[model samples]
Target: MLNAVEFQAKIQNGLIQIPDEYKQEFGEGDDIKVIVLVQKKSFPKKDIIDELTENPVQVNSVLSREEIYSR
Candidate 1:
């Protein structure tokens, strides 16, 4: 019988960092979904209202950055 692998999600700077342990569990092009609890921070009445009305930020599990060469 085949077994299913498990994975956990991590949030940093509004980015989702997928653990390397799941590399073998999922395929390179597979899609994954996870539920995250958004913390409601205490803010001033106006700030709180504005924040609540806006959409939350989400990032992919994997990401990268590049630097260009300068002459």
Candidate 2:
């Protein structure tokens, strides 16, 4: 059987301390697993021009007199 308990705590000295209430569910010699999720501080902003420039074909280069007439 498996049981799951979720809670948030601050890590100190690279260690996370489990609360006392849930600790009693496990015996002294029992093995346990832990997972940690770190919150990202911020996301980088992208400019519209920067995104368009990444394309292989530039609109300016393809904008010729013949190309415009053919359209």
Candidate 3:
């Protein structure tokens, strides 16, 4: 198990989303992550640039995080 992680993203479908800033920073199929953690695990997530790529200049991205599961 791990703790909280912040990621830049935009809102869509009432769900947390990924940012499109990775296109230049990362690339196609890059294991891009904004935070560093000790415990790593697989996650079912939307592609970072899938939605924003259409119009990179239109959408505003924000940093989000994964709250630590302290149970």
Best by the TM-score measure: 2
| lDDT tens digits by residue: candidate 1, 1-71 | 35455445557799876677766676788766656666666854667667766965575663444323331
* Per-model TM-score versus the true fold: 0.32, 0.52, 0.22
Error of 1 at 66 (Å): 77
lDDT of 2 by residue, 1-71 (tens): 88888888888998888888877887887777778888767877768877777864545555779878998
Each model's Cα RMSD: 22.0, 6.4, 25.4
lDDT of 3 by residue, 1-71 (tens): 33334565544786555455534555478664444333435655657686567656653664355433432
lDDT of each: 0.62, 0.79, 0.51
Q: What shift in Å separates residue 32 of candidate 2 from its native position after superposition?
A: 1.4
Between candidates 1 and 2, the TM-score winner: 2
- Residue pairs whose backbone atoms clash in candidate 2: none
Question: What shift in Å separates residue 18 of candidate 3 from its native position after superposition?
Answer: 6.2
Q: Which one is best on lDDT?
A: 2
**What is residue 47's positional error in candidate 3, in angstroms?**
40
The clash count of every prediction, one per candidate, is 0, 0, 3
